[model samples]
Structure formats: C-alpha cells, structure tokens
Target: MEAKVILIIVTTGLIWLIQLSSVEATQWHSKQLLPYFRRIKLDKTKNSVYQHTVKDAIRMHLRIPLMQKALCLPKGTKVSKHLQYADVSFALIILKSHCFHCVLQLSSDCLNRMVDKARQHENKFYARFTYACKTHAEYSSDCMESGRPMYYRNLRNLVKQTEKCWKL
Candidate 1:
C-alpha cells in the first residue's frame, strides 16, 4: 500500500512540474515573439522612404570605386598587405574561411566599395535630415503663417524619421 502511495505521489509531482514548465514557456513566447513579429511587419510597410534614400546613396557611393579603379589603383593590394602584416592574420583567415566559405564571398575590391558606399549613404542621410530639422526650426513661424500646417506636420514627421534613421 505504501509503495503504491509513493508511486502516485511521484507521478503527480512530475505532472505538476511539466505543467508549470509549459506555462512558463507560453509566457516567454507571448512576451518575446509577439513584439518581434509585429516590428518586422511594421518595418516592411514603412521602409519606402528609407529605401529610396539608400538607393540614391548607394548609387553615388559606387562611383568612387570606379573612379579609383580608373585612376589605376589595383584593388585588394593594400588590404592583402595589411592582413598579411597583422599579427592576427592566421585567426582572421580561419574566421573568414569558416564564416564566408570563400566561394560565395565578394572579392576584396567589391566588398570595400560596398562598405564605402554604405558609409556614404549613412552620412548623407544623417546630414540631409539634420539640415531639414534646422531649416524648419529656423522658419517654423513662416510655416505657421503660410495658412497651411503642412510644413509643421512635415517637420514633425522629419523628426520621427530622423529618429528611426539614427536607430539604423
């Protein structure tokens, strides 16, 4: 009788533990996953302005490398030398090969050009937004007097957009 009683108690304890774990897991999913998926959906719909800005910035950015190549500086020459001279060359080689597999990787020339273009785009976007904010703040009264609140609304939107861009 005592053996049967202990067996029942053990089974009940195990069931209770399993139920508690499942409840915790559900709570975690609701707290973490819901916001992540919602943000992704929001990001997709609202990215048009950023997309156009990035595209223009990238286009202008790509020209610099073409100009450099035209000027006769061979690509990868400086980077290869720098990598070879660095003390972490072996570790870097292993990491590069492991992560990128080398086969589908961009050539050093192309990678550098793309990185530069991205940097330029980021700078340009920041500058454009900053200038807009400054200009609007200086002439806010003009905007208010123009018989349309469009400029103030635009300025508010610009501030919000700038915040989003900076987060990027």
Candidate 2:
C-alpha cells in the first residue's frame, strides 16, 4: 500500500514538472524577442495604423521558432557556417508564403529577379535570416494597407513543419 502511494506521488510530481516546462517553452519566444522589442524605432510622425502595422509585422517575424536558432545564435558561432547544415528551404518557405503568395500578381521577370537575389546571396546566411523578417514586415505592412488578402494568406502559410525546415 505504501509503495503504491509513493508511486502515485512521484507520478504526480513528474506531471507537474512536465507541465511547467511546457509553459516555459511557450514563453521562450517572448523572452527572446525582448531585445528587438526594446530597439524598435516607433516613428511618432507616422500615422498610428502605419506604426502599428510595421511593428506588428516585425514582432511576428522575430517570433518565428525555426529561425530563432539562427537569429539568436550562440556566442562565437558564425551564421553562415551554421547555415551550411541548415535546410536552405526555410528561405523558400518564407518567400513562397509571403512574397510569392499571389503568384498571378507577380510578373515572371519580377519573380525571376527575387529568386535570383535569394540564390545569389546564398552565403549571406545571417543577413538573409534577419533581413527576411524585416523585409517581410515592410511588405506585410504594404499588403495590409492595400487590403490585399495576400497578408492573410501569408499568415496562414507562415510555418509549415517540413522535414527540411524542422530538422536541426
């Protein structure tokens, strides 16, 4: 009887610990973004909608989990070197989900140019990671202002858990 009681207590304790850890994991994104949040330059001269839209977009991109490891990289780790092992398709996923959402709206020439740029800057891993988010924010704000459904579509497709993207 005593042994069974002890077993139940241990099980309960383990369950509580697991739950606490899960909660911490969810908060990790917010914690990591604190620095960026503090550094945001809110232009008082701009309209409230414009300020909010850009800020929101920046927040959303900075919080992406897959890119977190790359964004807040380890001390002394070179992002370009780190990215050699990273699945390059993550960039594609972002570009496809955001910049290429409305394929019909983009001219073949424009699409080719963007694709060429992404490919051309393959070695610029950290820049690509950080720039993609900042760039997305700017583009996102435009779509939001223009009332393009592309912004909503991009939100829905933002994070697809592919083997390539999820693989660490």
Candidate 3:
C-alpha cells in the first residue's frame, strides 16, 4: 500500500508538468505563425491614420502660424494661409474661454498666439480665466463671487469634474 501511494503521487506530478509544457508549446507555435508584423500593421495602418484624419478635420479652418510652424518642421517650407485663420481662431477662443478651464491651461505660446489674434477683435465676450491645483481649497475670491471662472488642484478627476460642471 505504501508503494502504491508513492506511485500515484509521482504520476500526478508528471501530469502537471506535461500540461504546463503543452501550454508553453502551443503559445510558441501560435506566436510563430502570427508574427509581430500583424499587430504593428493594424496600429500604424489603421488607428494612427484614423487619429490623423480626426485631427485634420478639427483644425480645418484655423489659420495658426505657430501651429503651422510646428507642423512644417519636416516639410521644409513656409505655409502662408494660416496667419489669417489664426486671427479668426483667436476671437472664437476668447469668446468661449469665459467658461472653459482647459483653454486657460494651454501653454504660454499658444495663449500668446491666441491673444495676438484676439487683439484684432473687440473682445466682447470678456474671457474670465483663472488657474487651480487639484485640491478644491484654492478657490479664487473673484471666481466665487461672480460664479464664473474657478480654480482646482491638479488632481486626476479634475477634468471629469470640470466637464460635469460645464455640462450644466
């Protein structure tokens, strides 16, 4: 009876090892048949191009020189048409910026370009803007009084909360 129990234990161990090896072999064979090229082709040929197209559609009418300069880095030529378009974009941004925090947080250079464009117009909408960290404790007194522009801490959920507030 002792010998029989030992044999059963040994058999079970061998069966587990064999199953593990089979799984490894199947993975190797499947990987060999597919190759990495198939996965890369899908990302570059599909998703990347799709993202580029969407970006193109959104920037259609904006004639931004700084944006054109950034885009033309590899192209080695100057684009002239965007200068006029940038001005138009600036006016629209200032009008909408009265209530959008994302617009306020854009880089200094982008804001400069937008302001330059805005200078050409009468700034009728009065773009009230402010900054915030993630914590809600840093509210600006002006923002609270007007119930307009507000600040926040740089917390991860800030964008979500901002979107929620703006939606209302």
Winner by TM-score: 2
* Runs in model 1 lying further than 4 Å from the true structure: 37-168
Scanning candidate 2 in windows of ten residues, the lowest lDDT window is 97-106
Worst 10 residues of 3 by lDDT: 120-129
lDDT of 3 at 165: 31
Candidate 3 C-alpha error for residue 131, in Å: 47
Q: Residue 129 of model 3: what lDDT?
A: 17
Q: What is the per-residue lDDT of model 3 for residues 1-168, given as tens digits with 9 covering 90 to 100?
A: 999999999998987666545433323322332221122121233234333432332233222222322222212234443234333334332323222221112233433433333222211111221233223323344423332222111111222332233211
TM-score list, all predictions: 0.23, 0.35, 0.23
Error of 1 at 146 (Å): 36
lDDT of each: 0.35, 0.37, 0.31
lDDT assessment of candidate 3:
0.31
Estimate, for each residue in 48-161, the C-alpha lDDT of model 1 and write its tens digit: 654454443333333222222222223432322211113133333333222221112113343343344334434444444444444454224432233123323433343333
Error of 3 at 10 (Å): 1.8
lDDT of 2 by residue, 20-138 (tens): 44434323432433343344455476456645654454344322332333232233322232232132333333332223111112123432332333223221322223344453554
